[model samples]
Target: MMKLLRLCALLICMSNAWLLQAQTTDSISKIDSLRIKQIIQSGSTGKEDNNRNVLLNAANNTSPRDVNIGLPSSVGGITILENDLPVVYFFWPELPTTTWRQSVGLERTGLLKMNQVALTMGDLGFAVNSYSQTGTKEFKFKSRFTTSHYGWLQGDVNVSGPMSKNGWTYSVGAFLNYDPSTYTLGFARNAEEAKIFRAGITKYFDDDRGKITLNYKYTDSYNLVNYALFNYQTNGQVRELDNFRIGRDSYILSDGAVRFKDVRSGEYYMANLTGNEVTSSSHTINLFGNYKLENDWNFKFSTQFRSSKAARILLPPLSIFSTNAPAQSGNTYTIASTGERYEGNVGTQLAMNTPPTPLTTVQGRFSLEKKVDNHFLTFGLLEQFYRVNQFVSNRSFFYQTAEAQPRLLIGPNTDEYGFYGYNLGSEYHNGIENKLSIYANDEWKVNDRFNLNYGLIFRNHIVNGDYSQTPRTPDFTLQNATFTDINYSWYHIGGSANATYNLTRQFGLMADFQYTEQNRQLEGYSLPEPARTNKIRSPLGAFGIFYNNDFIQLISQATFLTRNDYLSRFNLVNPVNASEAVATTTYYDIQTIGWTTDFVLNPFKGFNLHYLITLQNPVYKNFNFEAFGVNYNYSDNNVLGVSKVLMEIDPSYEYKKWKVWASFRYFSDQFANLTNVLYFAPRWETFGGVSYKLNKNIDLNGRVINFLNQRGASGTVNGAELVTDASLYENRLLTGSYMMPFTVQFSVGINF
Candidate 1:
């Protein structure tokens, strides 16, 4: 921590090594607007040293950027942080968005819906949105600023002397990010705090045929604190539900005062136990590293290791509502989660709160890749192990104030309420994965008559996790000891192929096909085992043409995508999670297809046009996490974007000296989670700014985004929230991180 503080202190006294916008009348009057094709972006280096000439317009509009990844960096190339998504319906730097890596890579490593993506223009990259508030009240937005926005300060120092002559570079790099908007799930008053550090080294060896790359990275989002919010519709509306089991049956809580199982328990401790401990320090440290080989003929390897431990204060995976179980209407109830005393369901809704569990995941990764001539081949063999020493709560203060009911002491022995708190004391998980793929790609330059650019991909995947929940269980109980004994294996074979033949210089014919098959099975006697298989795909066939002006730089392609067998990571769960499998014995499948056309036209100077039209039908699948029943899926997504040179409105202003632009988009989901309801979210994202002469030695500039703020829906979803039909009240949330409102920023700086 002290090291980080010291590093931050030095930043105020230092200036970046490079500046992107060096435009000035004296600098260049002849080169006004840069062509679209000329812009370039280098991910591994500084600005000018790795520059491109993509002109950007200030005062830009809001629109969903294309998800395509094959386009050069000038188009779109932003990574999303799924854990923290923007509040608005559009893209926000802090909100959850999709990562661009999936659009191009053969594999995805993170959660599917959590990452936030950024769009880039030329050497500059930024995201815009309509709503920007992180909370569930009012709308607030942070301006879109390049350079300092998610940009990392990275470089390496190589000290190999003459050995560096062979390009044998051994390097080290570090970067830090401080964003108040990225903190606390917006539940707390303060923004989420994030800190990241990365270092790596490379060795060029074996005549350049083999280079060794090693890297270490760490990221921590901590010190997050938020108070409970009490803004029910009309304050004391008290929409309550009682989930009870009359007699011996178990019923989900919905209508208040419902009965539960035959409540039973052992005598509680009669002695007073007052315990308190304090130490000056507590922390969690995780160390991770990976080794990679530089090879071309299909050979690669990588390994990783990580270990972590947390402070003792976070102990106790407890929640308030979990403590109060029906006590036969008379017996003293010993609560495990919240110790708050309760007579009935009155005055109780006010105290209801979710569990506060903090996790410590220590994981490792191993991967390999290979390619052979016309056919590309890759394999990822991984063994990841997680060591969880203890489960802690981030809400210890809340628990401390509610000790009215006999509370549960963290330990081995406990009742039903206590057992829930003892979900997992300490355990380790060893997950193994094997993934293989092969593809053939090539572009046939068949005169000016016809052209073909396409390939095929085949993949096979299998995964197994070896671990257990709580190791200790009471005797005579059906036990689930070593999860290692329960095996889950899923196999998948997928491939994609496309061909585009140029019929004329202004038009072309193209078609593409994709297919995937997945099978899942579990191995265990006590554990239920189910085998299931599913095949999914997207059939895209389209024909179009375009003109290219290598000078003004204009190109366009109008093609259609017939999306078939659309699937989500969770939706594609072969056998689904264990508990779910035992309940349904069936899998979730999305077998519907949709068709959409995307057109990109960049004509004349300093202008570009992009639009998409999509239509889809409903399909049968489980909605949300609940296996209530299968239903048809319905929805539509439409997007459009246009960029123009601000200077075009006034020739007096040099194009390179000033800029402005705007984009807009709309998305409507009639039935969210396949439930019967209309959910619509519309967004207008825009960015506007210009460079002004603040004297010969200084310049003034600024930008704004999420100006016309509006969010679709936001609410609670922490397991129990489902009891009161929380999904029904989702649209009532006033603030959300999904849509950060619009805001503007201005800054003046010296040229030197």
Candidate 2:
């Protein structure tokens, strides 16, 4: 803690000194509009750099999250969009893990476009376009090879040029990535691996004002699921284990395979934990075009068709207890395939697997825009269709707890089916979803000192599906079950209004308000009888002031947001006994009021500093649920996985052909569970890098992640939902995820 404080103080002192010196200098001038736009778009004053694009958007003051790694990201506590379209798969608004990683390769992207508006008229009005074309005619070729300290290697090659003299352009790229986990696992060769290929062709017409492009992408990926287990005190302080390093050791077993019946088919099969990996694949095609019309009018259209398959294989810990506990007697725990008693701390884990499930989707959008006087108006339509066939099977297994490489165990209660208890063949879902949206927006310049923007949107959502699940009963068996039909529909209307007033050439004031309505998602259809509740409503309001100069630029804003009717599901275990558990669904609401400030300081020549700070109170309201035939109310609890404060400071210096930069991010304490009793301490994630432009066609770069080596846990605590009271769980064991350890990466880039 002291070290972190000292670092913060040092940075602040340096910034103040630089600011004073810059103010007294006679070389400073007013910042130009082009430079301001660059800062707003890339979060830096210098040329675009992938390493500096850490914050998703400077306006919201939030960072991007990796959905593949079980992290959820939001813009002002709301779901974000991709290319002005919702990225929904099943119930969540996140694309399949492999699809995102493959489509957005490390070195394939030529440009990143972001549109942020304080309105709900355009599908959240905050979207990121990551797949824009290069639009280059001259020959261009680029390749990069990167190696990490942990023996991971990644590489990509891209080339684009004119296919023919008759206005045809083409591009092709390939990427390969291999990443072992932060901690090496004895049972797996690599924790994550991926291969991606992309190709595109474009034809220009009407002097480049009109063009059509067709693109194809393919991705194959594999990943391993793992986490860390530790003990915690009543005060929410984590306890270190004797032989296990929190961020440098893994507890997955080498011989943890299990036999289980398929959810859709009754045939039995053995699922291996070693050598074999969970794999997924995807194929995507995109067709898009835009044309400029006469009389200041324009037209644009885009369409996509995708067929993909996703695989799931997880061994999530449910509970941990001592061997001498009351629940371990009477031959309750024994060595796997044997009758010998097992002695040690034991962890109950759910071995869950789902065969590669098929998914197909088609989406299209069309828009028209016109400019009249000081007003710019746009009208658009969007349509999407998705189909998914999924099946999941689960079995319970016991393992002796250790710092690394545990051994599986079986109990007398284990049935002939090779599972200890409950939910043998878990779930099956076959579903189809359709969405249609119509929206219109207008931007008007009221005067030289005043501007106004407003928009309205309407959306229709529909779902049709068949679902079934096994009952959570002891000694359950895989039974042939029939599926149930599910049919539902919803209508939504939303809009926003925004205004900005420039008081002077260097200062401005702005305010905006937005509102939207949400409905039940398709994932809820898996239940035999889905819950019927009021439409979830979300409302947001913001007010801010901005100032810009040659030495520094700043924007400070205060925002209030409220969202209700949230739905979630969890499987909780009895703390006293590892054999007993319950599956539950919960409904809740959240309200938050936050303040955010973004700063871009060019205090001296060739030196730039970008800083952002966010402080917010995101708390639950009317959070009530039922489990074990008991009602639990946790109103006024802090929202899980959300910190009250977030800060990012990045500073870079450029001199001739050499550039150096560092980024420091700090997250305050966050609640780890619904009860708000378990929490993770504050932590810092620091990164530093240096690059040398060795001639115009070659570059050398080196980067270090977690350079400060702060080894702390992140994400939510596993299976702690039943611990509503903290006093009873003092000194009890807990299982959760840990941050990545320190590592270094070096890369060589070649371009011609």
Candidate 3:
């Protein structure tokens, strides 16, 4: 009884404080409006003028504000003014009190509960939010834990405070979050536990004309499934591929031409229950600064560096055991024992040593902007460098001794190293990539009726790497592929122009054009081909008209695009000639045309509706390529995986303290390859959510993430034809795979 009384008293006090704050806001708003009018009449619009700055600040009530010093709260917190008194705040102070409704913003909706809000006062601000939820999986599989049941408990905290209040203003803040992650995707067998931490400091100098900020973040995550477990634990899928059974307790790749399974593990191969966990750690630092120079010029710069390491403790897949069967024909191989046609390795159960992987990146950007009369100009430079080092080892065995029919050797206690006949050895790779770019843009307003914006960019990329694959002991008939100094460099130039002309306040016309000449880098496949031209020249043009008013908006656009020298991959018997045998790259050209329309309606004060539709046609416009020992024409063919139609509708309503919304997305049938022999059915997905604010500090929400339960293949595999021995191999569309099934989640959050 005493605790209940205390809570009631606290609620009363808060309500009173909020009411006073609201009254104060109204009075201040009126005063500020009058002051703004006076300043405008006086023509005091200089950027360095204090009254102009105050007027600008007042105009952007929706703009993001820096967190309070020493406070971690991100919610609508107490905002202190240098002159005016701070107002008491809540989850949605912007909403009218009589409506008893939170703002329509997604952050205020309990159903989504995707963000945290905070309040701040003066140099001190703090915000906190936390939630716990349960989720069930679509697939029912048994492993370390049943795939059906999952749950997570997570919490976040943020704080900020003034570091110094001298001529140079300074502030510092910290944020932390903890998540016991669950298998919301239904692909991984294990739940992850993660801890994230970040800290930042900001300083203002040059009479508040410039500001600089430095931030650091660290993350530690554990209990992730390793490669082997990921392959064996998921249901009906192995290593992100659909598992197919060819015979009783036997299976061959159903999508591809490959025929074989790891017979050694028997049915339902049990992954190693121990030492199959993956752990990852990352550290990142960023430095950003912005300065306002003389003559209406502004400058901004930012640099970021990150390093990450992941350790995997699992064995590699075993090698396939194929006998020296009679070679029936080209692109065809037979396993002498099983009398089965084979295209790829099929075996399993190897005690391979695991290794740690390392990755690093450095990125930076600098920009300068100037405003002169009715024109805004900007110039920028960007750079990024990335590197990775990895080492992998796996060994498989095949025994065809006089006493035993060529059987794969594997087991929990099998001496794989001692009885290895074909020890598929280790590999090492060191890779690096660097990209740089420079660009300039200008936005010009010729008059009240017309506006134009244009920009051009120049970019360059350099990639170099070293890779080596050790040959299997006793030489397993596979040649060792190694490159000591693989290198590639490419450059590109791109430009774009956009223009808009206003016929009246409610109607306008817009046009856009873009062109580019680019050479794409063939990542990881550094072996150069003399006959391949990896260059592409693309141009796009669009014209559109739009109408906007107090209650409705509509926009329509028609676009035409073309690509020259588009890169395409092919398998050649020879790299130099199509008649020879080797894997190679090829080039082609493509074109596309599309039309899009979007409509938005605000029929009432608290209701909104949006509709969009798109129709497109894309086709290849050139040449031929060889794969699976056959040449095929692709001219005038539909571009692979391009859809012809797309549509979406979203509607929302808000009244009192209730907020509700629903959305739908649709896509037409799409082809899988240029041949147009394979296609996937159309897809439809639906989503909805409802939220209610129970009080100023608490909210409740429910969301239907995928209420329709639509099931269809999400993606296609294009290499099945390359692996087939027959001519005109059709691309494989994975069956039984699907987007997320029907799901509902509910959340309750307490804001402080």
Candidate 4:
């Protein structure tokens, strides 16, 4: 409550300051209204041209596969933001619903609307505008329906028009999606669903110097949580079981269910895995305005408030062990349901349930820009506040591993709680965070052939939180616990410099450098002993050359990035005793050296090709930690789940009324463990699509994903973090995620 009052006070102060500044500015001549209108229209389009940033390559123009996660492109070898503040208030443990990306009048790249070039892991300080359209009075209606082969259906409708001739406009959009799992799992099919709605209204001033927009969005969604199991081969490869297809079968049981204890209340509950899925919902509102001030100064401000309840439920595979091995009581395992002896491998899975975490967030940004002779300057302030009430619980179960569908198993002493295995624990966290930053940027055109840009930022971050954990007793019942307060604060100062020099009419050289220092996030506070409050330092440098002409455009860049004081939690098993496991929090460092090349070739009038290639060497450094009184080190090990080589080739041909395109992507081998013992082989994915313009208002499209039927696994292997010797269990079973199999999709769209 105190935090809320403080936030309100801060906002009120800022508002008063803005009013004072606007009222004190001297009278000035009216600006070019037509140019201002053009700028507004361009902002709404969400596209940028002639950007020379190495990270903003043409290959990144495609829409992201999952906006909830982030863009597919990575900066400095980190794909996702460390915190959710830059995107959403919170994210689901399993899969969350898409946010602003699905709204009408929004850009594919969220930064485009803000006139930003790119976002990096160390520099995720940006504000997102919801939906605002201005300029000419126009009306548009668009609707699309899509169906995939694996029982996936999606529909989207968007409408925007002038509500009044006197400069009022409105936009409304709805998105619905239902996706079955990639595999043909009978019970868990169609286990994911999402429904999102967005609405916005804009009022443009008659003088065309200012506009105000108000936007609202609501989202409700749920997703299935399951992965595939594989067998590790002696040759550092993975293979499917005899009866189980790698990408065609699921390990989830038809009658799967979980029993867990609620963290808030000391009550136990049985959650059915079928129709009673955990659902999540969120509501967000945004108010934004921009105006042309005196003396050619432009002012922009936006504020967003959101409230959400995020829920998570998943059955994740933990570890695999031979059922023939002696149990804690020197007895073999048996089927709990059928009372039959089990002789094969058995996999331990965890039933994790995080019931509806309530969260509230408020974000605001204010900026002023002015153009001077040969230089453009911008000053901005960003503030964010969020509070989260979180709770999570985990219960363990045992299943006899099989070629196809696995069967539940139990030992001689099944727990009194009716669990096949023991209960892990339940945890509760109540936290609030506040962040404020002040920044300034300048773009200088030194000459026609040379340009320079730079920015500096200073931030103060504070987190106040309380955490508690309830452990299971000998009888598998949860024990009562009391919360402990945890508070911390950190300061950050970061800067970036970029320069471009034109060598010739069609060629240019560009270079950039960025550095940041800040403390780790609140995720580390839940540990038994809170993680060290160390500052994380990140540095990135890049140099690139580009050539542009009528027929071809090419950019090749090289980058070097290093990050220190990285913290993470890993579940490690004792090498000597497979059953002895512990979750430990550790710190490490990462270094990456990479090269990327992108090409857009239009050799002829009707054909175009977009080719991109990336090569990177990312490694761990000083990665030493202790767990269970044992010391371990993984220094200089290759990072897991990051391929050294990646390539994509996309080509399209456009005829009078028809267009066809195909994309081919390749990924080199990648390690699956920090020890670099287990790895997956190279893989290829192919996609092709054809679109027909039926008329001015209608279009039809069809696409095929994974047309080559590639069957390969991706993602880190569960419970393999401590496996330093691959030969110890060459033929043992492991679990991880797999690539989706071949699928077809068809869509029809109507636009007016």
Ten consecutive residues with minimal summed lDDT in candidate 1? 114-123
Provide TM-scores for the models.
Answer: 0.48, 0.85, 0.59, 0.85
- Sort by TM-score, best first: what order? 2, 4, 3, 1
What is the TM-score of candidate 1? 0.48
Model 1's alpha-carbon lDDT is 0.26
Among all windows of ten consecutive residues in candidate 4, which has the lowest summed lDDT? 29-38
lDDT, candidate 3, at 243: 35
Per-residue lDDT of model 1, residues 1-752, tens digit only: 34223333332122111011111211242101111111111111111210111122221111133332111112112323211121111121111211111110111122111001111110111222111011111121111112223221211111111234554343222223233331122122222233334334445444444444444444433322112211123221221112311111111111111111110111221110111111011121211212233444333333333222222112211223222334233433333345544332211111111121122222222233343443333333322222222121111111212211122322123243332222111212323333343434444444454433333444444445433433322221113443433344444444433344444554445543434343331111111222233433333333333333332212222322332322222111111121111112223332223334344445546555444443333243442343435332333321111111111111112355554444444333322222322222323334445567656655666645444544222222111211224343342321111333244555554322
Per residue, candidate 3 scores C-alpha lDDT tens digits across 647-727 of 668898999999998877766765543455545567775778898988876777776645776534433322222222222
Best by lDDT: 2
Q: Order the candidate numbers by lDDT, best to worst.
A: 2, 4, 3, 1
The candidate scoring highest on TM-score is 2
Task: Please state every model's RMSD to the true fold in angstroms.
Answer: 17.0, 13.4, 18.5, 8.4
Residue range 107-145, candidate 2, lDDT tens digits: 232122111332323333222334534334788887888
Candidate 1 ranges with C-alpha deviation above 4 Å: 1-163, 182-190, 203-212, 222-430, 458-460, 466-491, 519-586, 621-654, 685-703, 711-737, 743-752
Candidate 4: where is the Cα deviation over 4 Å?
1-85, 90-136, 186-188, 274-277, 325-341, 393-397, 400-405, 412-427, 468-479
